[model samples]
Target: MRITLHEVSKGRAGQALPSMSLEFHSGAVRFALAETEQRPTVLGLIASGRMKPDTGRVTIDDTANPKELRRRIALVDAPDVSDPHPDITLAGVVGEELMFAGVGATPLHARRWLTQLGYNELASTPIGNIDPAARVRILCELAVLRDGVDGVVLVAPDRHGGSPDGWWRIAGEFADRGYAMLVIIGGSAAVALERMQEFEAINASGPVQPLVLEAPADADADADAEPADEDAEPELSAAEPAEAAASGPWVAEAVEAPEPDPLEEEAEALREAQGPASSIEASDTDTDTDTTENGAAR
Candidate 1:
């Protein structure tokens, strides 16, 4: 898959964003780190299929509907558990997402993905009960469920705080699988080096500004921004054994049972109370997590 951007800009709060352009091709992944003040709107555009060059054009090859294009390109970011069910288990969250994506209704696929991404033990644990790193891993699994996905895009504030090494291992696996990925992180030379070791490039952006520096000079300067290196390995540590178990080899277990569908239950209740409406009003809201520039919500 190929993603082409041309002078695409987004407006917010009555301000036109700075024009930006870029291209991402198959077999190559890009890494970018931007401050909250200078993040670009490219990710939002890509996620929403609203990427259009102000002076040129943005074309995606081999895609029909831009909305369905998400199936081929997965965007992973921090978990948003602000909804009513913060106590839902990781497995439950994955199941819900799969069902929403119309992939499958079984937990088996979710279990395998969580395991492959190294979050198997947390499969049955509520999302809010886990630490930040575990939550990030679950987010990654949720973003990239299908095997043949064209690309994976991830946004995070910082990777060094929890387990920098573990992040690299996972990113490396995605690269090895020929999945083009774009990771956004805070300014850190060490993090950039680690990402570039596996990714194709390390770009920069910010929240207030739409400019994206694809080829940043002074690569060493970013390294200075990293915190003092801790004894953390570039792999999962003993502190997170459940994470290890979650990423362990998949084991077939007896299927427990089935549960009631919440949507169906709601529909049933609605019917019981009153006759259903002729048609449900469709929502046009963009559901991509990358809708925001940097960490600031757009």
Candidate 2:
């Protein structure tokens, strides 16, 4: 599969994309998640080929219409489940997707994918009854049907329902089968960084790009603060050494230290000085009470 974007820019409500251009080819999997307001336009370019730039062109295998070109490409968008036929079973929906792409869906392949994705029990259930994660898995399976498959595109927000290991496992499967993937996401930099690291760790040869969506000016301030705010919290693993270093000297110094608060020391001293006077007052009061009782009896 080969993809090329030339100065593709889309605008909405006064903001425009950064006049982006990129390309992806076979034997390489490129990952990018849309951020900012351009997410929809980016997705549109991938899905319907409707968001093409006025000044430039997007070509897939030399075809101008990405959607038409996607016939040879397996495209997976999780939200596209909204268009699933109400009466179609989960397996049926997957079968239809494969069939529409001119691929035959063997029962074995469908069952394997459904079970691997934790959707085995819902294999016969309607698409509407299946959960989002299951839908995502179905889309992933469709992306990589058999070895030597032509092209595949998978798009979803980051933090999809899967453990880190699970995510890497699926990604690895695609890479192993030699399918190019495009991931659309809305998440923090840390999350995106972790994803890129996962891709590199699995296949050192894979191509991945973190496309940060530029938020509005006011929103960018808040987005910029998120990392700093997270950085302020000390990690347990990191703080332990610092704590030990600080404690050693502090403990030694504290051993010889006087009262830290002068007012507390003064109050303690005052209480100690008043102790004898209070005891004498108590004795005098007891004697006066005894004398008063004796006088009353006489």
The local distance difference test score of each candidate is 0.58, 0.58
What tens-digit string does per-residue lDDT give for candidate 2 at 126-203? 876655555555666765554444655555534344443444446556656766555445556337557768767878
User: Over the stretch 132-215, how does candidate 1's per-residue lDDT look in tens digits?
Assistant: 556655665556665546776655525325555556556656666776766655667346556655544323332355687665
TM-score of each: 0.48, 0.48
Q: What is residue 193's positional error in candidate 1, in angstroms?
A: 3.6
Model 1: residue 67 alpha-carbon error in angstroms: 4.9
Backbone clash count for every predicted candidate, in the order shown: 14, 0
Please give the RMSD to the true structure for each candidate, in Å.
47.6, 22.7
Give candidate 1's whole-model lDDT: 0.58
